[model samples]
Target chain A: MKGFLLQGKNLSRLRGRLKSALLVRIAVYLLLVDLAFVFAYPFLYMMVTSLKSPQDVRDITVNWLPSGLHWNNYRLSFSLLGYPSALARTVLVVGGCTLGHLFSCSFVGYGFARFSFRGKSLFFLLLLLSIIVPVQTIIVPEYIFFSGAGFLGTYLPMMVPSWLGFGLSGGLFIFIFRLFYISLPRSLEEAAGIDGCGAVSTFFRIALPASRSSVMVCLVLSLVWHWNDYFEPLIYITQQKKYLLPMLLPGLYRIMGGMQDASLSGGDALGDIYTEAVAMAATFLVVLPLLIAYLFLQKKFVQGVERSGITGE
Target chain B: MKLSYSQKRRWSGYVFLLPWLVGAAFFLVYPFVFSIALSVSDLENNNFTKMFFVGLANYKKAFVTDVEFVPKFLTVVTDTLINTPMIVIFAFLTAIMVSRDIKGKGIFRALFFLPVLLGTGFVMQQLQGQSIQSGSLEVARGILLPEKLQAYLGYEITGYITAFFNRITIVMWGSGVQIVIMLAGIQSIAPALYEVARVDGATEWEMFWKITLPMSAPILLLCIVYTIAASFTGSSQVVDYIISLAFGTAVPQFAYSAAMGWIYFLFVLAVILLVFLMMRRPVNRVAQR
Candidate 1:
């Protein structure tokens, strides 16, 4: 009604209002663009700088666009970092973790959602506490325990926890899953009971399929978290062959340059430019798969977040 | 006593929770207990094959005699306190904007949330720290205060501002989850309430303050907690100090490191508990009112 009236009775005012609204919209868009650039420029710089030739990267002026793709930077990184093997190792670790979280955390979530057993609330509180306490606080002794048990230098510390449903962010995943499960109708359980289904069977057959969206959320989160995990691997896995991409990233400049020189982007001198490009290249390699996966799975991820928010469970 | 049907059903719940229970016992509980023991004991070995029980000596050393632990942890805490408001405000404001009927909102959301997909944990800290320092130092230097203001504020404040500008991108990047949560909070508000507000001639600003903000109080509290917890996480200086105390030196004083960790953990726990207590009262009052 306001718009219709403004269109005729206050035509001049409508023009002024439309102009102001347009100006405001343009300003908002500009702000958003600035923010997006701020968020994106780091990775964008990584990709662009990696492709720059040695001379192009080292020049005094900042050049955002590379002259050409320096696929050699990737080739060098691929060979130097043992990219194939490391990528496979990461995949194995991350894959195992996602599976572990999907099955085990969901099982735990089902228990929390369905049960009113003695000490259930206490156990749940403990679960919440686990999420709050910094794992770093316990790492001193935990690391010692692992090394003492000869579990250090292997994937045991990282993988074993996941297998047992206590992996990185496991508490949160279980919480999410429990929220999802509790939202299910009580009639489903009764129906399953009438159909001669046990709790385990019912969960496997009914609840698991029903909570597919949450499961996807857990899978993507677990996969992404495990894939990008640098610290745990840094602590536990000492073997060069076992190092994930991130752990290898800091060392790439050193390995590629074969010099005890400073970090990759040393004083704007030309000497370190090639290594800087190589470092960016190595970073690109590490994050490429994640970027691709996010591009594909972003819809599902957003949906999951929306659902979780709506329930606020 | 013989169990009834409901009793059996209740007991069977434990069977389902057995894996997480056992994992929690070993992973979190046992490690926590071990941390307490290691903190109190007199252990100077790298691995813990050799140790002697000494009551609170490690804690005493960390708390009383330590040249670095308390101050270093406090520095991290201070850093967090300064940065938390900016991150949360940025997240909340951006979320409200994106939630409004706007063009290309999905694109904006995806762009804002890109950080969560890529940057997390130590990798993010290193990437952000190194990238910003080396790549953008010259750009940051352009924003230096004039001579008079710089002199008055001193290098301490001026230098902090410069460094904070360098860190601003990374800090904003940390708000991805918070933004999403707040966005969800906004969307979950009933549209009927908005319609009613519009009928009553409520301005957007008024509606935001009176309705949207108060309605999302629970989520805002969650975001604050997340921000606090995430601040202590990653490669924060506190964690670095603890790690260095345990592993950086030749003779790793595991017990001393454990003490430092416990102290830092207690400090973080206290901050979170305070936030909960502070937020809870207002929420309770709102409920009563």
Candidate 2:
């Protein structure tokens, strides 16, 4: 009877401890949610303000919530931004850049990881230096070179270097692939080699399949960078029709500013000046594809990011 | 192994390296040498034509005569000093918190990472209006919170407090990439260390300082380098000033802009190298010990 009583007391004590721990965990969870809200508030505000009417947006006091959703803002934004053409151009540039980087960087990475040769260390050091050196210093010469090649105003200047595996090597993609290749088992390759497979075949049959996660990681990063890139397209493509999304949005903003000048003579000037709400809608349209891509690929993207050791490696 | 076959295989390795060798020679090495040459030359007749070599004259003009150089450079430096510490600390703390068991961890990671995807230029423009407006809004709201408390504290204390506030906002905006990096670092650490600490009856705070901090040093260095690089590359103030000087209505000159870029590049290079050397020593010691 005494033993049973001791057991009951001990059980009660354990239950109390478990309840307190659960409470602590809940508190931590709430704190994390609050922290995320703090960080995300600006983006939410931007989205909300975008939905507000021009008059509402321009008010001296900021409104935390829109009075009502303005759907026409989006239609106006599309026409005002010339967003269709911009979207097409952006897709072309990003797609072309992605393909170029994948082909060129993968080949180069394969070569470095698999081969042993003279000047290999020296070549790797040069690659590292390429990463360290700021691209700004080289922009002038690159512009001059591209102009001389008659590749200016075309997507070639942006897309072709990636094909040559030029700027892509210095990025973490190369290192990640290299490390991944190092960790891969060599017996598969050895067996293939013994079966009369060529180097290219071995790479295709064995290494390529093994590095899918790394490849996905590279693709996502390349797409993001290329999509967001404003400066290169700005410098190279002076033609408004060929401008990518980033360039196009800023150009639209500029055009909007011009239209805002009531002194303009054209009949179309007033029509071209989008409402403030429309401008916000236009911003959303510009970023929509990226957001869509992020939504679908978020799982693979996170996995790839976690595996790439981007912060740690 | 047969000696003859080994020799043939070794020679084939050189053949495999041919593409990268050609690429480096044409793209990297050539441009590096050409940059040095271009930096010294003078542009004539609308930037399409070039004149004779000007030696260190361009560098001299940037350092000695350029009006905007010093102020822009100072702004960059000041911003870097303000922004980097907050980012590093917040990233570290977030990593610690997220590393623990929690619900919706993935969503939290995504939230932190979303801003990095927004890129610098867009984010800066968004911040430009919001930051200015928010300052006024806060004042109008008459919130007697941190700012009021700081004012009551001495002037130096107030300055530090304001500085802290500026950094926190910057950090909150910029934490995406840093948080992702820190998360990877935290994940890479063997869980066994934590388990060992728990066995030793170590407190959470003690374990964090003793184990987490030391193990995370490599990643911390990477974060510092990335943050610094991102700051210079992404600063809208720098970009706007330079672009205006380069292509703006006021002096549309390529040579002057090139000169300024070279100067900025040199300064950044010096700082990066110094930091690299300092960071490298600790990593080496850690490896040795």
Candidate 3:
């Protein structure tokens, strides 16, 4: 009787364990869903807030969804913010800078990895230490130096540095490229040489092409970084026409405030709150292109991060 | 021909490195020297030629009389200290979860990483500006417990959570790279060790501490460094404040601003150094074992 009772207890315990396991799984799933929501809510909020009619924006009792989309906010913001010129300059600066990083950083990396140059140790030390220089600390002198040389308000202030391989996070780029090149077998270079490829052509045809993934890594990263570099552009480009996307987005708030929209004068004192919606609309417009680019290049970006950004091994 | 062959290899290296050499001089070395000059001089807005040396006065003024700089800097330093570990641990835990055999892992990974891309240039600026300007600091109030629960936990624990509460967005946004790094670390841990641990009747929890954590020492160190560096350089806290002071409408105090930047940077370096020292023993032990 005692043995049978023990079996019965054991079976009951087994059933209880199974039930708890199922419960735990459900809890995990719920937690993950909540995390996803937390991560996504801001972007979703940005989108919903942007599309709200100015009335819906100020009404405290309104539902989460907008009653009607207000498309005019985008148009008003664009012209007032000088969107066309800002967009052009942003592309020119960011695009040119990314190209410069790819070429300059890779060139340096190839040399460091493949050859024994004079003062290599000193150069290497500088390269390593350069990683730690806070961009803010140098801004004062850099600005003075640039503006003193008749560059400041021009794109040259940013473009020239980028072309020289001294743009933002340039050291990290060089490090990553050097690492990638080092890992590639030295036999490959000898093979290229045996095929009568000169050093320049070998780098161009063999080494460069082999570093396609690293190039993608630098390209995507540099593009995003330069595109969003707020302070460098802020200090350098004072002209409205020279504003980048980051610079222009903030300026749109002023433009929205200046707009003579009839919807803003609802006399509720709370009607002043509609500017929040307009500001969000302006922000959404700024982020839209990058989001589109991200959607398409999502796999490549993540892959690059995995391969080059933080691979510990 | 033999000499030429050997010399060609040496010469080509310098040729390739020329751009970076120029960049180092103009971009790296020059700025560093110029920064020292500015910090030690009574330099003012765009006035390059008429600067006078002021020794450590600007640095001293930052602590003694400049009310805005000292308190603002201390708050930022404290915030960074509290935030970095929380972000690293949270990322590690989340990475473990995502690396499991869960459904829709790809989508979740993408969603989680979206913040990193968004938080970079304009979006980050907008987020900071909006929260500060629009007085939405109460956004994290949703995380508070019921009154009964709070009472049960008492004020101290609850207060700690509340203090950490306001930093939720910064933590979450700052964690994308860390999560990726942690995921890679977890994945890199040898599967054979876990199989052995299981055979030896080890629970998943034990396996984590014994197998996973030890194997991931280097990666964890990397994550800590990355977290500290990213938060220091990326955030618009003290750096932004200094920038504003440097370019404020009244009159730009270049000397004072340079001194302030250097002081803030020292804190960043100190934090990184502290973490590296703390982790070094465990890392060496792990390697030895």
Candidate with the greatest DockQ versus the true structure: 1
lDDT of 1 by residue, B1-289 (tens): 9987698789879999999988888788889999898887875444466667898887888768987777887789888998888888889989988887888988988898777767674335545666445653332444334658868888788777767666677677888878977887778778988899989989767998988887777777778887988788666777977787666788777787888888888888899899999899655644463
lDDT score, candidate 3, position A234: 78
Sorted on TM-score, best first, the list reads 1, 3, 2
TM-score of 3: 0.86
Q: What is candidate 3's TM-score for chain A?
A: 0.82
TM-score of chain B, candidate 3? 0.83
Q: Can you tell me the CAPRI class of model 2?
A: acceptable
Candidate 3 stretches with Cα past 4 Å from truth are: A1-25, A82-85, A254-274, B1-10, B43-46, B125-139, B143-163, B199-201, B281-289
lDDT of each: 0.77, 0.69, 0.75
Candidate 2 lDDT, A1-313, residue by residue in tens: 5666348778798688789879878887877876777667556755775687654655546577666786777878887668877788789888888887776666667777777767778878776666555566566667778888899989887887777676533344565566567666789998998998877778888887877767877787677777877877788888877777777667566655455444234444463335455656777787789878888887877677667644323
Q: Could you estimate the TM-score for every candidate? A: 0.89, 0.86, 0.86
**What value of lDDT does candidate 1 attain over all alpha carbons?**
0.77
Docking class of 3: medium
Candidate 3 — which pairs collide?
none
Question: In model 2, which residue pairs have backbone atoms overlapping below 3 Å?
Answer: A311-B181
